[model samples]
Target: MAEEAGARREEAPEETIEDDDGYVEYVPVKKRRLLEQQKLLQRKGQNSSLVEDGRGAAESKPSLLVKASQLKKDQPEISATEQLVRQEKDMIDRLSERKTLMSVRELAKGITYTNPMQTDWRPPSHVRHMSEAECDEIRKQWHILVEGEEIPPPIKNFKDMRFPDPILRKLKEKSITRPTPIQVQGLPVILSGRDMIGIAFTGSGKTLVFVLPLIMLALQEEQSSSLGGGEGPFGLVVCPSRELARQTFDVVQEFTNVLREKNYPELRSMLCIGGIDMRSQLEVVKKGVHIVVATPGRLKDMLAKKKMNLDRCKYLTLDEADRLIDLGFEEDIREVFDHFKAQRQTLLFSATMPKKIQNFAKSALVKPVVVNVGRAGAANLDVIQEVEYVKQEAKIVYLLECLQKTPPPVLIFCENKSDVDDIHEYLLVKGVGAVAIHGGKDQEEREYAIASFKQGKKDVLVATDIASKGLDFPDIQHVINYDMPAEIENYVHRIGRTGRCGKTGIATSFINKNQSETILLDLKHLLKEARQRIPPVLATLDDPMDNVEEVARASGVKGCAYCGGLGHRIGECPKLEHQKSQAIAGTRRDYFGSGGYGGEI
Candidate 1:
């Protein structure tokens, strides 16, 4: 009976479904018992036509991502802004598609400075291979030390450094008789095309170290081939703050202007920062830029908008690296880095290099030379640090008394914007020349305040920690901290505003019961390290740094090595915890949503 049923199935012919074109195929599907077996045995047929119009199908279109990928392909109408952006993207794509003509490696990379530089003046290898005593003497005299394999010898004088006469004359015009400690060693490392991280005091001429090399780099690139429209930024300077960026831009302009006056190939530079006209920056970039000094936000925005490209950028300098990360520009910085297809000779310069930052910086560069002028996070010896304990209510009143200690060109730092304004208003009412700046102020007001202060029109510039990050004030004699900063690194920066450029200055900080013991502990150790006078309130705080090693070994939290805070370990660190919470809160928003310190200041 089973054989008979199989034979009947073979004769049924229900499996092969044929189309009108006569092509037939068998589709095997699960067989189910049905009450109407005869109806289930029917064959299924299809319309055989598979062409576009032959089938019931509509015309296809490019997907969102597909349409987005084609920059110049036919598409629907777009706005003027979109068209401009598309043009920029097309320009950047063309730049990236250019063929590489040569392969290069670090340590000069066969790219010698010849336009205005004298490579014939390079010191002989034997002279470069100085005896240990001579090297030690140079380092000791400058209080600078370097760590790396095959490190370049330090430059003794501006003349010995192979700099073009024009650059040297410009230096002399600026009254810079010789190289600072950082410039002594830093210039060689950078000029050799090696990546480097330079640590020095805030006012120790760190800017020149990167700037001079950048100028030389751009000069060489121009000598080989002039940058066409939408081509350059052979070098990039990333500053954390706008004021610092502008200062760098001015320096670049000064040197580039000197070169231009001498009738050298014009090296164009642009300052990309907030509060500036974007159209102006776009014009500069469109014309072609040899160097760009920019704040992280504006630079990142430009990169995102495809308005600028870093294909020709072989030199990258991050000024105030620690502050850049602290202000939450690390991601933006790395994103800006993604645009570089070629290798970059990266340099990171700052007054402080924390343990965490040091590690992260290493990962960003290719075998960097580390040149440290003093202990990382250590206060400047030129500044006399004094901590005073005062009640929160009476702190503002005592500020007047503190201002009397220093003459014109004073910086008063408060932790809050309201406090900065209140102090500024109070000082004005009390007949003290004061101007205020913070995150809350608009660009015009902040620039005016900084200009007033720098030109010495305003003796007292009341500000927050924003002013402390890499803003150079050569004549600042005193720095008064109205309320202590939350992080110890900020303390170093606040005090660093004074005591710059071979001059002695004073840094006075006020603390109250509201201040954290962690901050106090770090303050105590910093003062002790600097040999400054520690007040009674700070002196009473136990020194966590004393047994830091033992505690670190026991707890495995490393005892706050990240910020050099002696009061706690990494696990229990309030600053770190605050960072984690801020990161979780979506973005690193400032305490008051102003993106300033605690309260937008």
Candidate 2:
């Protein structure tokens, strides 16, 4: 093959164009390179078939070279799709560099400032607030106590606080005249920029205690920053369930809307929860939000997906802190704090404070001002608790009876999803206007059900523990516990649905020996404190020897058997002695066989 290629190269005519200082050349540039390629191909045995014919070899060599050039032209090149992807990646890198900010977690850890308790702080003269003595008297009267540090003096009215003018106006427009005991005490602590743990009953206006602070902080930050903050949330409110998150979001939106109307930048908020299309939430978040209210699960999922960022959040509120720990959000909450390294104001609010909540507070809050209203785990004092011993199978019968007697706008609580559905079905079948909400229902269904109940479209809202905490449904006439909660604290929240905002309401629990034995003692105590009637069956659970008179008083039972009078027992009754004397004289006359003046034959 090599000898044939050499013969073909020698046979081919060589032509060259000489330079100006010309010298003879054997081949032109194009033909010289082509002949060298053919010889190299022949030596490698690639053109061995053409080696058989000298004439065919010269003719096919040009064809083979043309084919090789075509092959090179047809080779794959970088595609538009790939090039566009590369460009997008480069753009993202540039954007990340420009958007870089301080890490919140690192800032939080690096903060070394300590908040010392104020021993001699006084109420400002400009504010129409209570004096230290007045505040202390009010706190003592309401059983409000601080575990660590004393908070600021309570505001006598909403106007006394140094809030933005618009916010203050909104407060009055809403007719929020006087603060509740918890609000009176908690608001001052939060507005003072201290980490706080608020322990109050379910309907003590705990929402506003943290929400007011959140709004104030956002307003101040915007006033300070010319460009405002980033797309991420500046305040993060984490609740245990989607419903509570949405409820909190509604409250935030209501007050923040005032900011927007006053020609301030809109204080945007995003609601993140499961059972909804996440893409919609992501789009809202991408457009930017100032506040984010979310459930722990959905919030954790968003953090993992990088759909939202909380590194810039300066305020963190855990609503229903105890419930969050019970719902298994401890790890998720820790993951959240990992992103919030910046020194932030932490607020923990719960109706009940178990040891778990205390531990969580110690870990999360920085020298928190603990404001506890009333005893922890105690239900609202305003609610009248009624316990009835109804068997599980007879619950429906007793429920119907109670509903017949009670007024409209009743809230029935069940322990689980299946019970919620069953009660809803039973109520509907009985021709009652009713709706159900539970974890099993979709987000839209649950929300619509709650809205309908709140709007009076449905008289009865059958629910599981979902509606037990932090949902403000106004004018709930009765809270019927169709099934006792496994957790005693939940009972407080369940009955708390009614008797909100200092309004009187009834909570009727269908207790049996099976499900309620664990919480019977606490239930009895709660009933006694509320001055409510205790059923005879539940009253028997306590020993008769212990506080018999007190038990009779709580049960509304008069110890007098003769006349059932409240002040005196039968032995101390004046009417009882007269009746006994008359009976004895009649008996003596009959036994003496009418020996006196009466002619008895």
Candidate 3:
């Protein structure tokens, strides 16, 4: 055996190393198991003690607490750079907080001032004052959790909130017989003139929660002092996408039209979005509008050009707040905040806001009350989620069958615009009705597609992630993900297109090996939480536990608190990696959005 080995070594040209004493043969991991590497230390010409293990286990294992000092020294540049970033952020936060505090105080001066028209929002003592048993029952029935002091009771119905006759008539016409769960709790919070962060599944009537109260705010401001031309937009609804903004604009216009029909003073509201005529928007702005629903990009552009101002703007609603803060819009939002002239009654609404972003959002408000229905970032319970493993190539063929799982008005979501086009064309060629929309599509085409789908002129709507943001598609019977989204939050939003307004729906996702294990891990946890049947693929996924508790050191959190990703702790989150920031273990938030970062948002 030795002779054969010697011959093989000679034939293979084994790597030779020269030591202090003489030349020696070096073993490699490819040639031997790592544990056997220690045998090399016994070689004749090797320095046994200095080159212990030779395989470098010490260099590979994560740093031991005892050797952290040495590791810190070894990574001088990385450590120093991280420290510099941390310190700089600390300084910026301090300065920003000071300025923010001043702004908050300036806005708070007349915060207690009440609006005359807003009185209808509060019902009589019998309805306004809820008993403890009733409150508990409401919470239990709706799976609602209310936090913060002096929160108003959730209205049992529209009449309990004392809506104006116009609103009642509109509700009756639309057949919205009662306030939705979110509206039930959310309307009272905003009507109470309190800052709010509301969490509910998409299509849970969240738009009405913020929109209804803002109308009252604008009318109140106008009643006391009529707004002059080019003088006022007392309420602003900021949405993450143009589609979402347009939908919100429609909602605002619908209710505004209802009020107009009742012969109330004209309360003009307009859509401030991109792809529309700038001249037209400016004309509306010049004539003065009471409430302006806008997308951030167009809003920022208008602000930059000084075409409009928020001098009288006090009611600010961030629809799909999480998406607004994320997607590189945080700076733009802070810039918008600078335009606010008073302490605005800010409201944040979304289906899936990460805990960290929620905290970051609250930093801009005063005593914000959080009203969570079911669980934040959770899949809608009304929707049945079906996850299936399909070969990447076969997904197209299987699409036809998935459509059969549900009736008409199915929404199919793809990650790529190209895929959307491909699917839309394939469906059309196969004799199925389909409409597609993506960012690349012209504004007119996108609007047409959405309108046609909403009107039930089309049986299917194929789109990209943009459509998944916050567009409300009524009575969608099914949502099919052509490809699994990389972010689980996006997955939650995509499925939410169905199962809206307390209606049952179905969601089918086609996944394969190409998708990352981490995202699948999140999907797995989400499904488990919702009590959905775990497919065999997801059921067998092994979720690795973090050795060190990150945000949870104090609160016992076992996963990421920032993005709700369970595959990694906050320190290792890929979402935050874009910032090139490293999280120091067990530190006060100063980074992931707030203090007490360990708990759920």
> Which residue window of length 10 is worst by lDDT in model 1?
112-121
- The TM-scores, one per candidate, come to 0.76, 0.69, 0.76
C-alpha local distance difference test of each model: 0.79, 0.74, 0.79
Stretches of model 2 off by over 4 angstroms after superposition:
1-123, 126-134, 226-230, 542-601
Q: Model 3 TM-score?
A: 0.76
What TM-score, to 2 decimals, does candidate 1 have? Answer: 0.76
Which regions of candidate 3 are displaced past 4 Å?
Answer: 1-121, 128-137, 545-558, 566-568, 578-601
List where candidate 1 sits over 4 angstroms from the true fold. 1-126, 129-133, 549-559, 566-568, 587-601
Residues 373-396, candidate 3, lDDT per residue (tens digit)?
A: 876788888999999999999999
lDDT by residue (tens digit), candidate 2, 16-39: 436479865565678778989988
- Which candidate achieves the best TM-score against the true structure? 3
Model 1, span 252-338: residue lDDT tens: 999989888888899999999999889999999888999999998989899989999998888899999888877877668767877
